[model samples]
Target: MKIGLYFGTFNPIHIGHLTIANHLAEHSDLDQVWFVVTPQSPFKKKSTLLDDHQRLEMVYRATKDYTKLRPSDIEFGLKQPNYTIDTLTYLEEKFPEYEFSLIMGEDNLKSFHKWKNYELILNNHNIYVYPRLSKGKIETQFNDHPKIHHVDAPIMELSSTFIRKSIKAGKNIRPMLPEHVWEYVDEMNFYK
Candidate 1:
């Protein structure tokens, strides 16, 4: 199976997140798109993040109906401040038959070289980068990389940060999130 790994905190799985996964599954060569919910990110603040289990549940709820998409708890047991290279190595060992690709935003690509073992990641796995609303252009160095493919996945300029802010402000965020996710958030009174 060819799986595209879309990693994020998912603070709460929203429509924008789903849109990219859906687009990749439908338009790309991938057979499955796994949303690998990050428990903690080295680049993000831990205080602003919700409980890992709750965030994972939201991803499961949001993707339950999509056959091509599935929620992954792969990072839950991994060490904190998870790095992409380590996850990729573990996944390859466990699922030897599966071909894994990295799915990321253009903004992330701008700083791809800074990631740990970035060269190894590019050498072993294909990177499907989608356009994002960013201030910088993708570096020319990545233009000729055979493993890198530029995908037209819609970058909804929507961030979990923005959604969380809206929820705290007592605004209706239903349109921005998956119905199941919104319901779970409402029921739990999350972000308030």
Candidate 2:
């Protein structure tokens, strides 16, 4: 089985996240799209992050109805500031029966070279990159680098950061998130 790993902090799982996953599962050949909830990302700011388990649970709740979209807490057991290469390697070794691929936005392509063991990840895994701003392209050195998989979900400018800011300010975010996600965020008092 082919699986696409859609890694994110999921600070608060929002509609854009769901839309991307839904589009990937609906259009791609992959069997499943797992939202791998990152405990901490090596490249992102750490101060504003929500609790790992809380974020994971929110993701799980938000995606419960979509059989094809599942939330993964694999990074919870891994080292702090988890890296993509490490997670991919671990998943590959742990689940040898499934072929794992990386799912990311086009913006990452420009900075992907900076990632640790980037070559190893490229050589080992297939990449499904969704089109984002300017639709970034790659000039890969490794023989089997990330392949671009154009996704056609609605172009959303709102990000988790933006959503968090709005929540903290007590601004209405009704349209930015799913109903279940909004309820969970409110119940948890996240970003407050």
Candidate 3:
């Protein structure tokens, strides 16, 4: 199976996330798109970021109905401040039968060269880049890289930070989230 790993903290999984993941799963050659819930870095004290499981639950609720999308908690057991290359290596060893690729935004692609062992990652795995309204120039080396595939997916400007701030301000941000995810966030009183 070919899986595109979509990594995020997903403090609260929202529509933007679902849209991109679903689009990639349906439009690209990928068999499935896994929402890899990134665990919070132990060194960073972020109160707004929900517990790993809580965020995972939100992801679960958001993607439950999508056949091509699933939630992954693989990073939760890894060392804190884990790098993508490390996770990719781990996943490759664990699931040797499957081909894994990365699903990232254009902005992330711009800073791709700075990542640890980026050359190794580029050589080993494919990177699916989606459009994002972000500032910065992409590295010239990646402009026509064979390993990187530019996916003409919709631009999602919505962010978890915006949702959190809206909820704290007593705004009804229900429309921004999936129905089940909204219920879960509301019930837990998260970001309020």
Candidate numbers, best lDDT first, in rank order: 1, 3, 2
For model 2, the superposed segments whose C-alpha errors exceed 4 Å read: 135-146
| C-alpha root-mean-square deviation, candidate 3 | 1.8
Residue-level lDDT tens digits of model 1 in 1-192 = 999999999997899899999999999999999999999988788999999999999999999999999999998988877799999999999999999999998878878888899999998999999888766656757877999999988778888999999999999999999999999999999998
List the RMSD of every prediction in angstroms: 1.2, 2.5, 1.8
**Which digits, one per residue and each the tens of the lDDT, describe model 3 over residues 13-91?**
8999999999999999999999999887543566767899999999999999999999999999998789999999999
Estimated TM-score for each candidate: 0.96, 0.90, 0.95
Tell how far residue 176 is off in model 1, in angstroms: 0.5
Between candidates 1 and 3, name the one with more favorable TM-score: 1
Highest lDDT model number? 1
At residue 26, what lDDT does model 2 achieve?
A: 88
In order, candidate lDDTs are: 0.92, 0.82, 0.91
Question: Which pairs clash (backbone N, Cα, C closer than 3 Å) in model 2?
Answer: none
In lDDT terms, how accurate is model 3?
0.91
> What's the distance in Å from true for residue 46, model 3?
2.9
